[model samples]
Target: MKVVSRIINVVLVIVVLCSLVAAIGSAITKEPMLLTVIRSNSMHPVWERGDMVIIENLKEEKTIHKEDIIFFKTEEGSLSKQGWIAHRVMSGSREEGFITKGDANKYTDQSSDGTVPIKQEWVAGKAITIGETPIVIPKIGYLSLWAEKFQSNPLLIPVIALVLAGLIAFGEIKFTKKRKKKSQGMELQLIYIVGGLTIAVIMGGTMLTSGQNLGLAYQVSDKSQGVIMGSDVGILKVGDKVSRPLSELSNNGAFPLIGTINTSDKQIELSHERVILSKGEQIKSTYTVKAEIPGKYESSIRVGLFYPFLPASLIYFLSEQSYWLALVSVSLVPGLPLMVYPFVNGKMRRKTAKLLRRKKRKIQSSLPF
Candidate 1:
């Protein structure tokens, strides 16, 4: 399993969960507190996407310390594109405010908004770790598509879920009971689940083929050079504008497309699966519409393993049920564990420290420093 993906999913679920907490918290308190989602990778490894946050507004004097995950409101970036960023406070104090930097970045972004000591009031709250968003829950965009298909016949989906759950649960229970009766007991049960999971992994892996699978017949988004198709990387034209499906486009190939860069096409100069059509080529005419490959319910799940959090989070956000309550509840659910995780982790750390100290003292008594 991809540890990063699991962490990201956990972040998304915690976000939904935290929103509920924030809602409740917001309702009960008479403060200017608010909650928002993590916008960037400023404070990563600790806080990933969909990580729910609690911003406790301290109006009078917002004090800060060395490493505080902060939500600093500022007029940074293009008004339209980069609205705000919530990064961790790298270093600073209440007097000099604080200098902040993203956990992942090499250097600090120390502007007034990026670096200055945030007034205690500007801060929201400390960040926390919740459980991961479930992988199964978010793929509902496809479900939503199917839901629309069965709109008039709505009961179709729920009935199916209930039925499937019931059947699987029943079979597993019966099989488990029978297995437990055997001499091998837990060993046999463990073996059965592991074997089943292994089969599933193989099946899922086989099913995933990737962009290369998009053949001549399958209509795919022709976001490439007008003349060439995918796997046919081309050069970038000065006047010909291009964009990629992904953020980072790797053009370290022989046929890098340098299409005419013009209006309507704006993206990273180099990114993959984006487009390389020249200025003249229309999005449609440039790329043949053989068979459009619809993006996954989530961002294309990382083919290999980085962490599927992005796609999973996307899937959760696009769940079939449009109810506000359901949406908020599910979003916060995964994050609830995150907030709890910090505390749990802190406790564990304290315990570990204490044990180390005791061991150290015993050693010192036996020997010397």
Candidate 2:
């Protein structure tokens, strides 16, 4: 077990070192923007989906020559699902921006401003290809894609994390007993209990947060076909004490603005309106509310988790999507207890060995006599 623990620790260290190197490289050369797995066939023939390509930031390489495969961000709210894009430079200069086109595509990404030029600020990095063929680590990209899909389910990650931690804690107890030739002491048991409790509390909080359906609930008072002045119909949860910011609803010139209405104002009568929220459109509102009673309560005021709320969904999704990276991080956690156990009990172990050695010496002395 000790030998296995040592090996695992070494492997974790190597993984961490490799990650640091990649991140540092990205920061320095901006080339090989870390390890980005291709998700589309737009760069097919040269690169394909499931292929991981290295990107180098254009900042490091000063020159942006034609035919260079560069990655850049799209215009804000362009609606392109691909957050960042990589394409070959077809025309234009680096001073202003460069015109880019995907090798597999027939038409350029031109807009009203002629060929849409990717500004210097948008250029992420250039792909480091060998002889027109970008280095491809095939099949591994599928793992990343799968992780991303699984991460979308909010509950999956937190549950899995807690389970993994529980398993590690159980394994550690057994291993420690085996090594020490006895059960762990009260101090060590207490430490394990505290750790377990901490994990439990955190997981419980995350679960509660995910299930909380807090949103805007509003109604028209005058009925003059005016915009909903206060809260829009949505899901919201009221928490005891403190306040949090909820979604912001814009009139957008579509609805007539009657006036500003709020529950806190005490002048407006807030009513609950059942609204089937538009999926994927979680609104960010400036309004905040404090619920004296915690539960699903409908009110005109938007309620949010109290200030300093953890972004449970975002955290869980990222952890699940970056499964490989998360595993590497978790591997380190298990190794810590294993390594520390030996150090913490080293004196006792050494004393036991010394006492056994002395007993053997005494028996040998008696036999000679």
Candidate 3:
């Protein structure tokens, strides 16, 4: 048993080291790809919470397998945006994009255009082994969520990273205290972990409260004065703030007008076409967007970012397997965590276990095991 434990310890250490290396390697080896922890059980038995996947765009002609883990773009917002989802490829032709279904679900994601065709180019790389073990990275989702707050304001990333690293280090402390009842202790530990996850969901939502429900960020391609895009909006002129698609423009609702915002010294600029002017007329001005929408989640949600469908399909898929329905159903929002404290507490507890034990002793001096 001692030998086995030593092996386990060695294994754990190797796992931690390798996971760290893979994470860093993934970050630096490719054009930086965001590490998305799978929150839904869809890709399950294969992917679970805490699994860290290194996503890199697949090169042209890379052969895809029937079950090779892949991520694809969906026009159906409920499924995923290019920036939004990480799921599994169920079926498809290289000539046609593969049909993708969450492992938890029964069917594939059906594109409105038709069965989605994954040309050789759209695949994100397969998830190699996680850390030193074969486990997936769902456990890391909580950490990724916490780490994101730092990304919003890069100044805080290092501080956040240090705190997270410290927490991870703390969880690694040797177990010095013996439990009076191992089963009860383990149950409490499991409950605590789940509780923490619930809190994390709440916190993720809370952070959304301050930011606009919708956010728009894109760059103007130098080649075109105008272009077709997802959101259709009228350009704001100096005095024409609320024009429909902005004065003499069609509101197709898919393409937002393209422009540049120069707020360098707070010198605002507004550019717009004349409301009634002919096609050849040029209109330009400086107009600062006042009272920006207070959340980007809705924009992403409507467009399928904070998707509830992934989780919904996952839950349903776990219970049953209605493939095509699941595919079409991937178009709605999924339930999100409403609390973040529990997850935070889990990390805190792991980090401070030794410290907590010290405090407990002062209160239990008379107790004899």
> What is the model-wide C-alpha lDDT for candidate 3?
0.40
lDDT of each: 0.38, 0.49, 0.40
Go through the candidates in order and give the clash count of each.
Answer: 64, 21, 67
Per-residue lDDT tens digits for candidate 1, residues 1-369, read 669988987876554344434433333332223554444555666655544444545444545656656655543322213434566777766656556667787866554333444455445455432443111122222322232232223234234434533554576667755653334323333333433333332222211211111111111233532333333223333334433342221222122222111111112222222344222332321221212332211111121111121243343333222223223333333233322332355554464466669777888899844
Q: Candidate 2 residues 203-319, lDDT tens each?
A: 333222222233344332222222344444222333222234543422222112111123443322333211222323233434434333323334443222210122334333333
Candidate 1, superposed: residue stretches over 4 Å from native? 1-35, 54-57, 76-81, 111-121, 128-369
lDDT of model 1 at position 346: 59
User: What are the per-model C-alpha RMSD values against the true structure?
Assistant: 23.1, 15.3, 18.0
Steric clash count of candidate 3:
67
**For residue 127, what is the lDDT in candidate 1?**
43
74 Cα displacement, candidate 2 (Å): 2.1
TM-score of 2: 0.43
Q: What TM-score do all the candidates reach, one by one?
A: 0.27, 0.43, 0.36
Q: How many collisions between residues are there in candidate 2?
A: 21
